[model samples]
Target: MSALLRAEGVGKAYTLRGKRVDILRDVDLAVRGGEVTALVGHSGSGKTTLLHILGLLTPPDSGRVFVADTDTSGLADGALADLRRTRLGFVFQSYNLLPQHSALRNVVLPYTGRGADGERHARALLDRVGLAERAHHLPSELSGGEQQRVALARALINDPPVVLADEPTGNLDTRSEETLLGLFRELADEGRAVLLVTHNPAVSEAADRVHRLDAGALVAEGSAA
Candidate 1:
């Protein structure tokens, strides 16, 4: 099967002060359907940079990103946005929820416009995340784990083919982290490509494959513990 998401010889850099600092170099990776792939690295090791590139939120300085065999490099910004909407779901460490919106509204916001069906779908997702009772609550009223679960529901709102998470469990306690990880595993089991960037040892151990990022490249690969 083809990779749902792939990066070939990908490179990224930033102008830090007067010099160009390389964040990723010659990075090649792929996430296939029915599997969870974990990218592990220390802080500032380009894990997030690579995730952004894969998500098409950032352009790579070199190399290419492919979504199911289509090179994203040739797509225009609007086209990229459309592809991202239909093909990719993203979860962030910060729980990037709209504080003003209720949990159900936040999940429905990803769709074009609000409708009865959309609300029903969003509510089902909230229920899946064990937040059905809190669907009407605002982000501030939810605990950290609840907020992250809401974010996860939002990510799946579109039923995309791939899910990319950056430090998804960074803020949760052990139980919450386990809950999120199980959801990720379920996503993979259902044939979605799940790629997550995490420094947490337990998260890495739960994946099907673990790739370590170091010195701007993929330094190692092994089966999960």
Candidate 2:
């Protein structure tokens, strides 16, 4: 199957101390449905930058980003925002939940649909993430794993086909990380494309395909053996 999200010859650079430093150069990647693609790179290797661009939160200095067949480079910020709301999901290392909100509330916060149906879906998602009993708990009452799971459920509120995760397991223990990976696999199995950025070997091993980056360039890529 073809990728639902794609980046072609993408490049980005920043000026630091009057010197130009390339964060990414000529990077090409494809995230297809039913697969988890892991981007593995060292610090400063531009993994997060590439993810931001792919998520439409940032634009590349050169090249183009494609969502299905639509070129997103020329899109205005409002268009990009609209596309992001409907077509993408995001998971972050910090979980990004509101401290004052219940798990159910946090999950339902992203829903752009009707409140009644959104609550029902949010409840179902909390159950799916193994947090149904804790649905009323606030972020302060949840463990890191539980909070991350809450964040995961929130990401699905819009039923986005593409999910982007950045260091999602960086704060979790081994057991939590394993559980999260299992959930990710299930998501892909359900026909969503998952693009994950990580520095963890276990995370990379769990992916269907792994991409490695170095010094602003894609260095290697392969399927898990």
Off by more than 4 A, model 2:
none
TM-score per prediction, in order, is: 0.96, 0.98
Which runs of model 1 end up more than 4 angstroms from their true locations? Answer: none
Name the top lDDT candidate: 2
Best by TM-score: 2
Error of 2 at 165 (Å): 0.4
| RMSD in angstroms between candidate 2 and the native structure over all alpha carbons | 0.8
Question: Model 1: which ten-residue window has the lowest total lDDT?
Answer: 111-120
- Candidate 1's displacement at residue 60, Å, is 0.5
